[model samples]
Structures are given as structure tokens and as C-alpha cells.
Target chain A: MNKSLNIDAQTVSVEANKTVEANNTVQAEKRLPGDLAMWFFILAELTVFAVLFIGFAVSEQLNVEMFVQGKAKLHQISGLINTLTLITSSFFVALALTQMHQGNGKQAAKLLVVAKLVACIYISVKIWEYLSLFEQGIDIETNTFFTLYFMITFFHLMHILLGMVILFFVAIKAAKNEYNASNISGFESGASYWHMVDLLWIILFPLIYVI
Target chain B: MQSTNANKKNTLSWLWLLILTVISTYIGSFLELFNTQKSLFIIIVLFIVFLKGQQIIDIFMELKKAPKLWRRLLFAYVILLPVIIGLIYLL
Candidate 1:
């Protein structure tokens, strides 16, 4: 009987170890919130922005007076408004992800719609700011400062547009209950991209408009 | 249950972000009006940008729960650029 008991104890220890290993696997899988591909894209996009920002800084150093004057001509209040709008949109996107995780796909879709609407407002404000600048004869080729400003902001605007397209598809899928807690990679990927847009704006707003 | 907890945490993070943005705007305006301590104000603004970027990465992007390498990459992106910008301005 003692021999049988020893064998049983060994079997239980092995089973326990197996269980622990399985749990670790699950935890490891859970650590990455979204698609690996999206993270790669984010890294690449950030690198481009970093390069552009460095170039802007170098150009600013060369023509501090022009940069300062160009900056003064910018509508600071409008930039501030756009900053707030993007932040609000990002907040909604986060909420949409949360709702998706909770298996509330319809709510998630609605939240994404709100995010898109706010993004539209941002685009509108940006256009208005650009138009006002044009009225003041501040086109892209006017100076180095204007060139950099137009390039960076317009490039960022293109990202926002692309993000909107991604959000459109994600929202449609989410509305159809395509994403749930167990399967939300697409939703997370789209949200991640949108947040990158906001993150870049958060940095850009200060770098160009305020500082 | 987990979703609810995550939602609360995200909402709190968003609130913190909004507050920081408001404070930064106020500081920006103040710097514009006063025009003294320009370097200090710029540093403060960049620091706020860094903090906001960190919050977005950690909370919204959910990188806080990610692997060490992923988190480090993002943290480096957020911190390094601003530090470089600050150094450029200061020097």
C-alpha cells in the first residue's frame, strides 16, 4: 500500500506541473494585446515621424527667426482645439475597445462612430486653419517653416484619413458582432492605429504650435 | 468582470490625459502672455507631451501588459524624441 501511495504522489506532482505550464502559456498569449503586425507598423510610422521632427528641428535652428514668425502666424487656439478633439476621439476609441471586450459590439460600434465624428471635427478645424493661413499668404513654398509645417501637418492629416477608413471597416465588423473578448485582434489593431494618430498629434501640436 | 475593471482603468487614464492637456494649454497661454522663462516653459510643455504619450502607450495602447521589449520600444520612442528636442533647444 505504501508503494502505491508513492506512485500516486508522483503522478499528482507531474499533473500539477503540467497545469502550471498550461497556465503560463495562456498568460503569455494574453500579454500581447493586439496583432504583432500592427506593432511593427506603429514602430515604422514612429520612426518616420522622428526623422521628420529631427529635420524640422535642424531647419528651425538654421532659421530661428522664420520659424518663430511662422509659428506666431499659426492659430494657436485652433491647434489647441484640434488637440482636445483628437484626445476626445482617442478616449472614445479606448471605450469602444473596452465595449468590444465586454461583448457589447453594438456599443463598441456606436463609440467608434462617435470617435469618427470627433475626428471629422478635427479635420474641419485643420482645414479652416489651413484656409486662414492661405488667406494670409502662407502657402507651403512660402518659406522653410511653412514647408515643414505643411508637410508634417498634411502628412499627419493623411494618417487621420487612413485611420478613419480603418475605423469604418472595424466599426462595421464590430457592429456585426465579429469581435469579442476571445477574438478582438482586428478591433485592437484599428484602435492602436487611431491612438498613434492621436499620439503624433499630441507631440506635433506642442512642437509646432506652442513651442 | 475583467472588462469592467479594464474600462474603469481606461476611463481614469483618459480623464488624467484631458486634465493634463488642459493644464498644458493653460501653461502655453501663460507663456505666450508672459514670454519670460521661455526655456523652462518649453521644457515643461515637452515634459507634459511625454507624460501624455506615456499614458497613451501604457493605457490606451495596452503596452503596459505587453512584453518588456515592446514596452521598452514605445517608452524609448516617447521619451527619446522629446529629450532630443529639449537638448536641441537648450544647446
Candidate 2:
């Protein structure tokens, strides 16, 4: 009888352990998905944009007329179009990450290509806008507004180019199935950088063209 | 099946982001360009920006499940900067 009770207790303990393990898996703790270094880089990039944005705003306050006048010269439709393109491209990047997570690297590669194409529209529109401004005698020395406008938008455009290069590199690797369900840190890190670029533009749009 | 559901949710969030962008553009034009309702423009536009920024941070950046410190730091920047800019414009 003592032997029987010992076996029964051992069976109960084993069952309890299994249940605990199952629960632990089902309720896995949340974690950030990419490189910690990438997160720090994003933070640094955001801080730079924040400082520039604040400077632009404070300058706006000091010279409302110049800012308003400069903003008027800018094409609101171009701003709107660029905003739409960036956001759409960002959506595709997110979708690509999802595909990567599902072990569909080919699809993710295709999605990244699509995203880059969309971002190309933004590049085209912005360049045309700059050319038009130049035709109208607008330059960095045009006024405080144009000076900041040229400075800030030009800085942001460089970021978009850098992001495109990063995404391109990731997409090429993803096409070879380098990233999968178990290995996606590099892809996630690149995607995070792309998102950061989009985030900066979201704020820049209204700050420069609208209000 | 779970991945499909996640994709669906992301597409829905993308739709929301598009809607917010459209709304902000329309409002900005109506108020700032037309020079009508100027007083309310900054608040409304900045609020929309906050929503858009929050969505990108959560859904796109995938920072929603991150540690509280990182998520909160980004959130603070999105909110605080606009508040400061809006205050400067308003006052």
C-alpha cells in the first residue's frame, strides 16, 4: 500500500510540472523583437529631429509672417502626396516583417520591393517641388522660413535615402531566405529604422507645410 | 491561421492611419489655408499627429510589446514635442 501511494504521488507531481510548463509557453512573456543597438540608434535619430523641429517652431513664433509666407509658397498637395506615400510604404514594410515572421521570405522580399517603389514616388515629388522652388527664386537665404524649410526637409530626404539602402540590403538577404521564423533580428532592425524615418516625416509634414 | 489574423489586424491599423492622415490634411487645408478657425487648427492638427505617431510606434515599430521604458520614452517624445510646438504657436 505504501508503494502504491508513492507511485501515485510521483504521478501527481509529474502531471503538475507538465501543466506548469504548458501554461508558461501559452503565456510567454513579451519581448522587444530587434537589436537593442537598433533601438538606441532610433532614439538618437529621434532626438536630432526633435531638436530641429523645436528650432523651427520657435523660429516660427518669432517670425510668424515669414513662416506663413514661406509656407504659402510651398505646395500643400505635394506635402499631402508625400505623406500618403510614406505612410503606404511604411505599411508595406510592416507587412513584409509579418511575412518574414511566417517564414515567407520571398513574399517579404517582394513586399520590400513594393515599398521602395512607393517611396520613389515621394522622392520624385519632393525633387520636383525643390526644382519649382528654385525656379521661383527660393533658396536657403530666401528667409528664415525657407532657410529652415530647406535645411529640415533636406536632412529628412537624406534619411529616406539611407533607409532605402538599408531596406534594399535586407530585402536582398530576405530573398535568399536568410530570415525566417527563428532568425529575423537583422530584418526587424532594418524595418525599425524604416519606421523611424516615416515617423519623423509624419511630424515634419504638418510642421513645415500645414501649421 | 494566427499569422493571417495578425496580418488582418495590421491592415486594419493601416486603414486607420490612412484615415487619420486624410482627416488631418483636410482639416489643415480648411483651417490654415482658408485662414478660418485658426485658433483651433494647432490643437486639432497636433492631436491627429499624436494619434498617427502612436499608431506607427505601436503597430509598425512593433514597440508595443517592448519594455515599458523604451515604449514610454518614444511615447513621451511624440506627445511632449507637439505640446511644446502647439503651445508656442498658440501663445
Candidate 3:
């Protein structure tokens, strides 16, 4: 009888240790989650956007009146909607990453699906906004604002499309239970990219639409 | 990851981002109202943008606990861009 109790106690202790170790593994200690190469890529991308952003600001400075007039024609409502949409998508992706870290791969996959759905809203709104501008005969060559507007926003749209594709593959892998607490680097890399897309649009909304 | 705490913080960050975005949009909507204090208004909007950018960097990007170098690089971008724009607009 004593032997059986001793065996059960040892089993319980070993199980507790495993749980603690699993939890600790999920909690990173002052480290980056994604690939170092992805960080370099992000820096490079930010540099390009920086130059484009600076150019737009300087051009607006050259002729504030023209820029303001150009801004008036852009759809503010659509801009606001897109900003909210991307931010929401990013939020979902963040949660999904957290879930993945906790070994909840299926739940994380579901969150990414939700993130992709929100991304689709952004795509739909953006395409509609573009078509509306076209309807109003406001192509890039129409003026300096339109030029920068089309160039900057279209560039951003392309990134969003790419991000969606990445998220799609990530979601599929996640649903397959491919990533777990210890092996989430690839998933983290994809999520970081999506957040970057969201980050760019946060700045772009005010730069292009409101400010 | 202490998921419950992490989730709570993320939800809070999302709420803050939502509030800040709406506030900036509302402020920018009042063209005539802000016409007189255009420079001041631009400054305020940039400040709000800074807040939103910080939230994105630290919360959504999950860079707060990252190495100081990486966090500072991204934060610098957020700071410099708005400052440059605000300076141009003010000028």
C-alpha cells in the first residue's frame, strides 16, 4: 500500500514539473520572437517608406494649398475604416501569437482566420476607395497630392495583399498543429510582418486623409 | 506567457488604439474649427499619432521586452517621422 502511494506521489510531482517547464518555455526571457533576418528586412522596408514619407511632406510644404485641396477630395470615411480594420487585424494576429505560444494551436489558427477576414475588409474598402477616386477622374497625374496618394497608398495596398498571403499559410500550418510553445519562430516572423503592415497604415491614415 | 494577463493587456492596448484613432479623426474633421489654430492642431494630431505608434510598437509588435537596440530603432522611426512632418507643417 505504501509503495503504491509513493509511486502516485512521484508521478504527481513529475507531472507538476513538466507543467512548470512548459509554462517557462512559453515565457521568453528578454528575447525577440522572430527571425533576425526578418528584423533586417523590416528595417530596410521602413527606410524606403521613410524616404517616401519625407518626399510627400516636403511636396506638401511646397504647396500647402494644393495639398489641402487635394486632401479634401479623398474619402475620409474610407480612410478611417481602413485604419480601424488594419488595427483590428493586427490585434487578432497578436492574440493568435499569444495563443500559439501557450500551445493552443487550434485556437491560434482560428484567430488568424479572423485576422484574415478583417484584412479582407481592408482590401475591399481600399479597392472601393480607389475606384471611387478613379470615377472622380482623380488619377495619380491629376496633381501632386493625387500622385503621392496613389503611389503611397497603392504601395501600401500591395503590402497588405502580401501579408494576407503569408497569414493564409501561417493559419494552415497552425491548424495542423505544426507550431507549439517551443517552435513558434516561423509563426512569429509572419505575425511580425502583419503588425508592420498595420503600423504603416496607422501613420498613413493621418498623413493621407486627415492631416 | 501567462496568457490571461497577456490577453488583458492586448485588449487594453487595442481599446487605446481605437480611442486614439477616433480622436485624431474627429480632431482632423473640424477643418474650419481648427483653421485658426492649424499649427496647434497639427501638433496635437501628431502627438496622438505618436501614442498610436507607440502602442503598435510595444503592444502589437511585442517589442517592449525585446533588446534595447531593436526597440529603440523602431521607436526612433516613429518619433522622427512625425517630428519631421510636424516641423514642415508648422513652417
Alpha-carbon lDDT, every model? 0.91, 0.90, 0.89
Cα lDDT for residue A170, candidate 1: 98
- What DockQ do the predictions score, one after another? 0.65, 0.74, 0.69
Q: Write the per-residue lDDT of candidate 1 for residues A104-183, one digit (tens) a residue.
A: 99999999999999999999999999999999987999999999999999999999999999999999999999887779
Model 1's DockQ score: 0.65
- Cα deviation of B42, candidate 3, in Å: 0.6
Flag the better candidate by TM-score, 1 or 2. 1
Ranking by TM-score: 1, 2, 3
lDDT of 3 at A85: 90
Off by over 4 Å in 3: A1-28
Q: Model 1, residue A103: displacement in angstroms?
A: 1.4
What's model 2's TM-score? 0.91
Error of 3 at B30 (Å): 2.3
In model 1, state the lDDT of residue A132: 95
- In the predicted model 3, the residue pairs found to clash are none
Considering chain A alone, report the TM-score of candidate 2 relative to the true chain A.
0.89
Q: In candidate 2, what are the lDDT values of residues A88-163, reduced to their tens digit? A: 9999999999999899999999999999999999999999999999999999998889989999999999999999
Q: What is the DockQ score of candidate 3, to 2 decimals? A: 0.69
Fraction of native Cα contacts reproduced by each candidate: 0.61, 0.71, 0.79
